[model samples]
Target: MKLSDAAVKKAKPEAKPYKLADGDGMYIEVMPSGSKYWRLKYRYAGKEKRLALGVYPEVSLKDARERRDAARKLIANGTDPGEAKQAQKREGKIAAANTFEAVAREWVENRSNDWTAGHKALTLRTLEQDAFPSIGRRPIAEISSSEVLATVRAIEKRGALEIAGRVLQRCSAVFRYAIATDRCKNNPAFKMSEALKSPTRSHYNTIEKGGFPKLLRDIDGYQGSPMTTYILQLMALTFTRTGELVNAEWKEIDLDRAEWLIPAERMKMRRPHLVPLSVQAVAVFREAAKLSGDRVHVFPNRNDPSQPASNAIILRALGRMGYTGKMTGHGFRSAASTMLNENKSKWGIHRDTIELQLAHVEKNASRAAYNFAEYLDERRTMMQQWADHLDKLKAGAEVVKLRA
Candidate 1:
C-alpha cells in the first residue's frame, strides 16, 4: 500500500518491530521505541538488499516515495542504490575538506618558509579580516568569479580600494594553488583583474632642497630624548624606510667596520641590505648604544624596552620640529634619492648603486645577483660623501644642487 502522511504519523509501535509496506520495495520500519524509519528493499546482483531512506515525519511519506522512485531508476541502470548513496557521502566529505579556507591555509603553509614572518602574519591577518568570513567555508570548486568579485566589492565599499585589490590578489594566489593541486578547476579571482576601483597615487610630502638645511638644523637641535635625536640623525644618514630604522638591532651593526647589515627578513625587498655607516652615522650609533645599553633593538621604545620605538615617535618629532606637511618620516628617502641622483656628477656616484642602496628590486635575475656584489667599494665611498654633503648643508656651506 502507498503510505499517506496521516497513516505514517498514526502508525504506532508494538512490542515487536513491524513493517508498513508502501509498495515498490519501499516500507516504513516501526520499532518498539516508536521510531519509524523509511527503508527500500530491492534486489542487486540477484541478492536482496535494503537502503535506509530516512526517519519518518522528518522525511515525510511524499519525500520517501520520491527517493524510492529515484533509487529504483538507479537500480534499473544496473547501479546499486546503497553504493550510490555512499559515493555521495564520500564526495560530500571530500568537498568539505576542499573548502576555500582549507586550500588557502594549505597554500600559505607551503609558502610560509619563503616569506618573512611579518609578511606571513599580515597575509593571514588580511584573509581572516576580509576573505574568510564571507567565502571561507565555500567549496573551492563551487565558488564562482562573481562570488569572488562580490567579496572584493564589499571591501571596496568600505573605501579601502588598495586593500580590496590586495585581497583579490591573495584570493587569486590561493585559487591558483588550488588549481595546481587539483582542488579547483578554475581561479575565480582571475576574472577580476580590472573589476576593482583604481587607487589614487599620492606622493609623500618632502622638503625642498632650499629647506633641507633648516630641516637638518632643526633635527640637530631637537630638544627631544637622546634616542629621538639620534633617530632623526640616523634616518637622515641612512635614508632607509622608517620601520627598518625603528626596528634596527645592535647585532645588525658593526661599528668597527662602519657597516649596518640589515637582515633579509627585515628588508622590504627580502634581501640583506648593507648600509655603509658614515663616520658621523657611526658616532650617532655610539651615542645610541650608551642609551640602549643591554637592549636588542638599537632604538628600543622608552615605554616598553622590549620593542622598537613606535613609528609615531619619528613622526611626532618631525611635527614638533615644525615640519608637519613640509616633510615626513618617509620623505627622507625621497629627498635622499632626489638630492643624491642630482649630485651624481659632483659625488661621482653611480645611479645603480643609489637604486640598489634604496633596496629597489632588479627585474633581471642574473643582473640582480651581479649588482648585489657589485660597487660595494663605490657605495662605501658614496655613503661617506653623502654624509659629508649633509654636514656641509647643516654648517651653512655652499652645497650647490647640480643641474639635471
Candidate 2:
C-alpha cells in the first residue's frame, strides 16, 4: 500500500528494523531506535540497488514518493539513478571550487612571473576592492555578460571611470583564462569596452620655450632650502620623471663616472636607465651630498630624514616663483623635449638619441632589451651641451644657436 502521512506518523518502532512498503520499490525504513529513513530500491543491469532519498519527517511522505517517481523515470531511460545522484554531487563540488575569484587568483598566480611585485600587488588589490565583493563567489561558467556589466557599472557610478575600465579589462583576462582552461565556454566580459564611460584627457602644465630663460633665472635666484634649490637645479638638468628623481638613492649616482644608473625596478618602463650627468649636474649633486651624504635618499625629507622628499616640494617652490598653474614638476620633461627637438639641427643630435635619453619605451621589443645603453656617446655630448645652454640662459646671456 502507498504510505499516508497519518499511517507513517503513527507507525512505531518494533523489536528491530522494519520496512513500511509504499510500493514501486519505495519504502520507509523504521529502526528500533525510533529513527525513520526514506529509501528507494531499484534494479539496474539485472542487479538490485538502494538510494537514500532523505530522513523521514524532513523528506515527508509526498516528497519521498516524488523522489521515487523521479528515480524510476531515470531507470526507465536506461540510466542508473544511484550513479546519476553521485555524478550530481561531484558536479556540485567542482562548481563550488571554480568560482570567479578562485579562477581569477589562479590566473594571476600563473602570470605573476612576468609582472613586478608592485604590479602584482596593485592588480590583486584592485580585484579585491572592486570586483570581488559582487560576483566573486558565483561560478565562472554561470556568470552572464549582464552580471559582469553590472559589476563594472558600480565602479563607474563612483566617478572612477579609469578604474572602472581597468577592472573590466582584468575581468576579461580572467574570463579568457577560464575559457582556455575549460572552466567556461565564453568570456562574459568580451566586447563590453564600449559600455564604459570614457575618461577625460588632460596634459601637464608647462612653460613655452620663450619663457624658459626667465623661469631658469627665477629658480636660480629663489631663496628656498639648499636641498630644494639643488633638487630644482638637478631636475632642470636631468629632466627625469618626478618620482624617479625624488626617490633616487646615493648609491645610484657615480660622481666619478658622471652617471646616474636608475635601476629597472624604479623606472616606469621596468628597464634600467642611464643618465649621463653633465658637469653642472655633478656640481648640484655635490652640494646636495653635503646635506644628505650620510642618508639613504639623496633628497631625504626634511621632516623625516628616512623617507624621500615629497614631489610637492618642487611644485611649492615653483608656486613661490609665481608659476603656480603655468608649470609643474613634470613640466621639466616637456620643456626639455620641446627645446631639444626644436633645436635638433643646432644641437647636432639625432631625434632618436633625444628620445632614448628621455627614457621612452622602444617599439621594437628585441632592440629594447639591449638598447638602454644605445647612443650613449651621443647622449653624453648632448647632455653637456644642454647644461651649458641652461647656464647661458640663467646668466641672461644671448641664446646662441649651436653649429651642427
Per-residue lDDT tens digits for candidate 2, residues 1-404, read 67889999998999999999999999999999999999999999999999999898989999999999999999999999999999999998898779999999998889776554567788999999999899999999999999999999999999988899999999999999999999999999999999889987334688877788899888878898988888788889999988789999999999988999998877776678899999889988999899999999999998999999998999999999999988898889988988899888997999988999998867887676656778999999999888988988777786554432
lDDT for model 1, on a 0 to 1 scale? 0.88
Candidate 2 error regions (>4 Å): 1-200, 209-214, 315-326, 393-396, 399-404
Per-prediction TM-score: 0.75, 0.67
| lDDT (Cα, tens digit) per residue for candidate 1, span 1-404 | 57778888898889999998989999999999999999999999999999999997799888999999999999999999999999999998998789999888898888876566777889999999999999999999999998999999999999998899999999999999999999989888886869789987434778788999899999999998989999999999999988889999999899999898888888765678888888889889999899895999999888889999998888899999888887888899998999999999888889998987888778787776633446788888888888888988998986653311
Residue pairs clashing in model 1 are none
Error of 1 at 80 (Å): 2.5
Can you tell me which runs of candidate 1 are displaced by over 4 Å? Answer: 1-43, 46-69, 93-103, 128-157, 168-198, 204-212, 319-328, 368-374, 399-404
Whole-model Cα lDDT per candidate? 0.88, 0.89
Query: Judged by TM-score, which candidate is best?
Result: 1
State which candidate has the highest lDDT.
Answer: 2
